[model samples]
Target: EADIYQTPRYLVIGTGKKITLECSQTMGHDKMYWYQQDPGMELHLIHYSYGVNSTEKGDLSSESTVSRIRTEHFPLTLESARPSHTSQYLCASTGLAQETQYFGPGTRLLVL
Candidate 1:
């Protein structure tokens, strides 16, 4: 099975609150990615990292930030979340850019 996980599954919070969406993987893959997706819709890449100490922002410049210190952990944090930040955050990993990615269930954030 794919060794990835996301917590809360669902979140409902008022606007202008701090939130952190947890993402973890046990597969030890070096390439991790974060994507924002609307409910029952397509996904938009928001963050990605090549490996430890190497992180980069995705096509979407998000209010959220991510970190990669260990091989199997990458968590995203939003300093102050807003209603516009409401979306599902999906975590994925691949052995290589050309390889197939393993995705987690995702965290659904609903900023009120």
Candidate 2:
């Protein structure tokens, strides 16, 4: 089993509604990342954190925000949901000395 976890594996929301997707890992990796992907499309990095109290926006422009206050927790929040936001959100983590990233089961979102 993967060490990472994502809550609410699927979500359906109306436009303009707010939502939050939770991600956590038991592996105690200091680096965590969030990626957004469409079916059959390449994944885009949306947010990332290096450690507690350090967070950064990723290469992609995302309406979602993420916070990292603990070593094993990284939660993403979308202030306003939209149909355009419908896609899969994936969470990943890597140890400081590791190059391989372990991914969690992605959360699929559908905004109506």
Candidate 3:
């Protein structure tokens, strides 16, 4: 697994707060993805990118946004967070072997 890390592993904030969950990978993988998961629930893909400047929404529709400005950085942002946005955001990256994914410690967001 690639060395991936997520910032602010746990967060609690009032509603309507602007939030940015940072994800950085040291393996320099080209394929990165963001997923959302509620407690004890299945994960849902929210965004992905094949490489820098190549971003696309994932299978699940999301109110948040993501950017791939650099190969090592992929951050998800909510312009205005809400209670409904409370969930764990996972960051994953796949190397040449696309089937294998290395995941970071997820950022658990709890918007009041």
Best by lDDT: 2
**Model 2 TM-score?**
0.98
Candidate 2: stretches off by over 4 Å? none
Compute the lDDT of residue 43 as modeled in candidate 3: 94
Which stretches of model 3 miss by more than 4 angstroms?
none
How does each model score on lDDT?
Answer: 0.90, 0.96, 0.94
| lDDT of candidate 3 over 2-112, digit per residue (tens) | 599999899999998999999999997999999999999999999999999999999999999999999999999999999999999999999867688999999999999
lDDT of 2: 0.96
Per-residue accuracy of model 1 over 20-109 as CA lDDT, tens digit each: 888889887899999999977888999999899888999988988999989788989999989999898999998864589999998989
Per TM-score, the best of the predicted structures is 2
Considering lDDT, which of the candidate structures 1 and 3 is the better prediction for this target? 3
Per-candidate TM vs. native? 0.94, 0.98, 0.96
Residue pairs in collision within model 2? none
Q: Least accurate stretch of 10 residues (summed lDDT) in model 2?
A: 63-72
